[model samples]
Target chain A: MSDEIAILGAGMHPWGKWGHNFVQYGVAAAREALADAGVPWQDIKFVSGGATIRCGYPGFVAGATFAQALGWQGAEVNTSYAACASGSQALAAARNKILSGECDVALVVGADTTPKGFLAPAGGYRPEDPDWVRFYLGITNPTYFALYARRRIDLYGDTLEDFAAVKVKNSLVGSKNPRARYRKCFTAEDVAASAMVADPLRLMDICATSDGGAALIVSSLEYARKLGKPNAPRVAAISTVTPTFASGVLEMPDIATDSAAASGVEAHAYRSMIPLKAYEEAGIGPEDISLAEVYDLSTALELDWIEDLQLAPRGESAGLLRAGDTALGGKIPVNVSGGLACFGEAVPAQALSQICELTWQLRGEAGDRQVEGAQVGITANQGLFGHGSSVIVKK
Target chain B: MSAKPLAPAIEGWHTMQVKPHLIGSQCTECGTYFFPKQNDYCRNPHCNSTNFREVELSRTGKVWSYTNACYKPPAPFVAADPFVPYAIAGVQLETEQMVILGQVIEGLTVDDLKVGMPMELVLEALHETDDDIKVTWKWQPLTQ
Candidate 1:
């Protein structure tokens, strides 16, 4: 296990439609994390924050904004924006600082209050922007999710019933998570009865837009040992990779995929590379992961992530789910914190929340949803504009 | 006013013809193709050649996958007054070995689409204002 940088504490503001400022949620989560770590705000040497674009000026300079809100003590600050992977990028920035001895203690926070309905592109008419072009062509995120879902159905013989099962499973575990937005267990019937936001994807199959925050406190292992926390869980590795040349799969916001005519495609799908890089950096394989938290914007996507993470062989995620291997008590339980299905997506906060869940699981502090004897965990997600991230944490 | 001279929602994207085709860029050195036309450099990491030529993509392809929007998308996606959900398809062009996404023709729905079915490109109205009708390329499954 790598002990380069220790995760001293992890915390989050309960996710819901709380209708508060993003800064307020971020500050609350930050305070909770600092208290949990037993670190004074003034002791933190640096702060790295994830930006939420919808908010005005403060959103752009979130690191300084959060530091000011927490009463700045002249801590060095930085901010990162990678859409859904923003939090992971922020954590990566903090981890690098701690490991390099540039900062003894670092705080990483991400928070967002997502606007309701389809996430629109930043207001503009720049014809050069692919996001604007896709929007004008009426391609929403769910539409892309549906295309993938339909392809899976045709290629792998997956059924709508199988997709509903994912929601049912995640909701059951989500109901046990007090911080999750949706606390009620959903049956397959409930999922089937929900309205279809995009064909082949029902309301329950898709996660909601929510408001929330998540934060983490990290320090060098030496500092962690000096602080009387000799056994703190540590961030083993973080992967923030972009797509390979001529990536064959169609990703979000882009109307087309890279051409495969020149650089012939790889045997594995593009998304799988994200976690593979993390596994390499951690010197661990898929078999070493006891649990995982993956981006599940839609039910079909959870299955896609399963294959991408190599939890199961290609085209076998549905079989794994049907066999109960991905449930709370099964081999390699995924998304024990209810996932996006229950928490909804708070954008910048979502990826950090995944890390928090993994931290809790590794430390054996997850009350009801704990994966027994969990030692190593991984969090995997993709962001708009070709950003992909995966983080590995170990107890 | 001559039906407002139907204009493409974005220029340099598709040809204004009865049977429309997407315009893409081809790397002269590596033979790679790019939609929405990459002019900066050859995207193939192995090839650093910057030379490119504009080419019209194949008008016919096969459906890689398809889905329909059941809810009205948010702006700047223009929708009909009553907001009729529309089907979209990802078509794998036979020549370039790339998949491009576009809305299906007006009469087609998700029910009419199946993977690997042959499809052809056509031009259709995306949305209209009092003065002009914005057009975009769409996919239509060819009758077997």
Candidate 2:
């Protein structure tokens, strides 16, 4: 209804390790979105940027950095940082401004340039910082992922083959996506042959860090109608909720989980709670989702996200994977953009990229990898420090 | 390196004595616990008690989930020069009802551990410094 913001355009700079400044990728993606929307750059009133802390102080003020890079037009600027959910938070800010009638049209953008090898924390004896503590305890990012993957084997009876199949499935479609990186199709044997980074997770099973950017052009329904494009896809909901106190599982960079020992405090899975608000705000359910794009930081995580999104019953995503139900042309096609499997992760940009993929799918323009009759698409992603995000985009 | 005395890597995190238990704080009102010492505030959404007491955690717990680090981690980890991989576990303490992560004691692999198995806390050398042998808490799997 009136609460929703129209997605007039979506664009992305191909995901890869190009070794360029992150600003270039953001500018390129922004220009592409501007061109795609047929909206003049000068017409945009607000620029909401998702931030990547790795890029230094400029990255912290990314909205102004990108605005100045695009030549300032006195447009208002804002920056949001929620780890991987940064993009959704930025989009939510833009949506709020639009709904509040402070501005009719806004640009939502995110970009990143990641370092090579494992992401480690700053040095010194800083027990107060969780990142430093986890690293000191020798817990890297993949360790958490491997823990979840191991649970699939120990509890869900999922095999290493099931985990490898997820990589195989996503890699096949990623090969066809021009915007994706690491386009080579991977085999189960390839995954098996890859060196184990963590038990049950090989090098190929975990996504790499990359430099890429994604952006969106959104406007009020009235602005779209005035532009003679009334049928643009709309963002019905954007949920960026935090975990209830006493998180059930140990999340990234945390050595211990919140204790559920206190009376009346229940430990809950944070991932499952993310999508519930999106479904409520969108007035839709998991059954209504025709497709999904999720954070697959690890191959097994895709399965966990599928269940978390309620796309499948708990511990049953492997069946969907085995039955080819999560691939292109399946009943509920997932990650038609090949997920983080192909894209690795550009952090801030990756979340908005999920939205860009859904926008393309809903507009019936995703050539080769398009899900047929994709009327409703939802996205789920999680990051460190209790960042949980889900968004619904519908025709 | 000169011979040096042994010390807790970060002071007050745990006891240095043999069979050491992790040192944490508990909310005086709600019974919620925190590791790495949290004496400031209670995190229970239901309880906002500002009062907390220092407490020793249960020495033994059950394995909630486990994994290994096949590659050496970056700075602050202080991996050996040759880099030996180590298995890590998330153990659910009986009293805390919370899972804590730590390295499985030396000479063990993921193949040697299973979920829900009992484990006890122990002190091990995290790394050796010129002035001290830095020790941290580790989890030792109990025989089934």
Q: lDDT (0-100) at residue A388 of candidate 2?
A: 74
What local lDDT score does residue A196 receive in model 2, on the 0 to 100 scale?
91
lDDT of 1 by residue, A1-395 (tens): 44358989988999999888999999999999999899999999999999999988999999999999999799999999998999999999998887777889999999998776667776767778888888888888888889989988999999999999999999999999999999999999999999987789998898889999999999998889999998998888899888776677788888988888874554334478789889998989999999999999999999999999999998999999999999999998989999999999999998999999998898899999999999999999879755679999998
Candidate 2 lDDT by residue in tens digits, A1-395:
88999999998999999989999999999999999999999999999999989989989999999999999999999999889999999999999999999999999999999987777788888988999988987899999999999988999999999989989999998999999998999999999999999998999999999999999999999999999879999999999877788886889878998988888876567798889999999999999999999999999999999999999999999999999999898888888898999999998898899999999999999999989999999999987766679999999
TM-score for candidate 1: 0.97
Candidate 2's error at B49, in angstroms? 1.2
Pairs clashing in candidate 1?
none
Worst 10 residues of 2 chain B by lDDT: B1-10
Worst 10 residues of 2 chain A by lDDT: A261-270
Residue B89's lDDT in candidate 2: 94
The per-candidate count of clashes, in order, stands at 0, 0
